[model samples]
Target: MPGSPNVLDLVHRSCTDVAAAHAEHVKIDDAAVSALAAELLQEREDVRAAVRGLPLPIKFSSLEQELTLLALYHLLDFGSGYDPLLTKTSGGRDARETLLFGLIGLHLGGTRMDHHKLKSFTMYDLYTTFNIEATQEVAVMPGVTMTKPGPLQPHAKALLTAINESGAALEEAGAKSPGELLLSLAEGLKKAGRTTAGAFVEELIDSLPGFRDSVLYDGRTLTLHRRAQNLAADLAIVYGGRDDRFAFSDVDQLAADSGATTIAVLRAKGVLQLSEELASTIDEGSELPAGPHERALRAAAVAACDRVVAAAAAQAAGSAEAAGPAAAAAGEEGEESGAAAGAGAAAAGAAAEAGKEGAGTGAGSTGPAPFRAVDVGAFLAFLTEEGRPLHGKITRHVTRDVTGY
Candidate 1:
């Protein structure tokens, strides 16, 4: 199984390999990665707080409903290309938040969002549900205008395609909803002695076309599987320890959700150095078509985030080791000494385990959760969000024609 070609492995390997090969447009800076990783390590509490703040405010009637909403939310998590339009139309909510609020509104309005309901959704229904205006004014003659399909129409169409395709796949597999499908996959993987996040992702990609986020580059397939990987990570975060059904032994193996925002944050932090042409293109707010340049940026972000996690884990381990001697010496005084020694030992052990897991060995390690690339991604995402310190500095690369994000 170590050498097996799973989806997670493909994502990590292809991204790193392609990034190393295609450095002309985007270059990864090792020193910047180390510095950023150290900064994130020192701000671990902030990272955790940001991640904890991600869940929607709505209360679900059941785990099934929660899973369904989360799944649908991630499924349509794209449309960053329409972020400006979305912000203007939705009164300041970005693309991701808009989607979440829209889905929540649907649930509150008595829609179950089951596979059948998803399949039955029309374009008009989506426009209404997401609160996007259906038409835009197009200037035809001088001082005259005509109504045409809105700028967000393409994004709405893409969202519709993703949901309809996902629903069809789930229905074909005898799943009533996304939650049911995920539960079935988990149970089946457990029964087969292959209960890991990578396996879950592989199965999800195989089951749904919408999750197969890969492209052919230079005759080789470069896989990102951003939505699929995030779905697994989200499930682990939402259900870990609360429900055994979603416990993934190798949750630490997941890479960062490689998307436009991730790349932008990395670039802003100096981790990714883009060529003049690409930088101008992104800085000018132009749409980055899904091509070699865009793929290079995303792939570089994934690989750089992996390095960041590794560096952070190493720093944590070093700090723990440095404190171990003092802690052991403090244990020689009184009753509290024994507890201090035990805490030190536990901290050192956790740090070592975190280092191993952060290396991305795919060993089914259940290490300290904060040392994973997913956590690093969450931290960067939080920093770059609207009104955050890094918001004005980072220009998110926009790709309009793809639903992979």
Candidate 2:
């Protein structure tokens, strides 16, 4: 068995030889094909037995056998003497990727076939599913991200484009690493049965803290929460388990894990807010938000809200653009003064105004532009006077107030 050929190689060779013999004897008898098939199976078993003596023998499992059977059915459906799963109705790229991977996985000894069960898969299957050369090329690119756009044919272009654009931002943010985030986004796009925008939001979380922080703080802001819930519910329906994070834990624990001292702290930080009585009621007996994945899920809600705000801003911009010169001027002025929230260029003006009143200026401006530069430190001081605990934690000095940076 040490010198014997690999079991799979032996089986495949036997099948090929038998098929050739059957073809040669076709004129003699229909029995020839049956005989050849029987011989192939017999030889396959013999090869398996012989290989058992070797250190690197292939093993078999029922799930693997089932997949092989599926592959056989697929091939037969394609009119090949050997089963092939190709079909005209199969949506192009996804179908091709699935067919190639599925077929390869069937031949390989070990593979996790279920989509929901994301265990390790065969190297052979991986190579088949993803083109090794293309992947290698992408891997070496300056700032590339890859996403698997799923089995649907229509969204491949959009999926690729999005990964290329957003992948860089994600890498910069240090949320999820670029590779994992890219694949996650791709899977969401392909299988989550959500809009492209919804999928994009998932990508945002993997790529940007603003989105991640937003998601952790709130879930009602974007359709992403709905889409994520739909995906979670779909998984529960198909897999016979609960995937909703809210069901896993309570508000108090969720707040604690999310970096707040209490449910009250969560409310004060705008992470969670409820009426005092309701809070008390839930606190008396409510599920605790536990697990890292659950926390991420809760965070996704807030991220969705951030996306909604962004969309609203863009819509407002569009409406303003249609309103003509005055609107355009206002928009440009807003950008320079940091009225366009999160603009980095306005930081200079903001820094100047931190301790004292200062004027802002734009690229082409002759004189200093009139803008309020409030001292965030002083602002915190005033908030501290109001007895807001968050004032003490405002050392990062982010001016979330859109009136200034």
Give the C-alpha lDDT of model 2: 0.28
Error of 1 at 365 (Å): 13
In order, how many clashes per candidate? 0, 21
Pick the TM-score winner: 1
Off by over 4 Å in 1: 1-4, 48-50, 137-147, 320-370
- Residue 227 C-alpha lDDT in model 2: 20
Using Cα atoms with residue i matched to residue i, what is each candidate's TM-score against the true structure?
0.87, 0.18
Clashing pairs in 1: none
Worst 10 contiguous positions by lDDT, candidate 2? 249-258
Q: What lDDT tens digits, residue by residue, belong to model 2 across residues 246-287?
A: 121111001101111222222333433333543453345432
Q: What is the lDDT of residue 112 in candidate 2?
A: 38
Q: What's the lDDT for residue 226 in model 2?
A: 24
Q: Over 4 Å off in model 2, which ranges?
A: 1-265, 270-273, 285-348, 351-405
How accurate locally, in lDDT, is each candidate? 0.79, 0.28
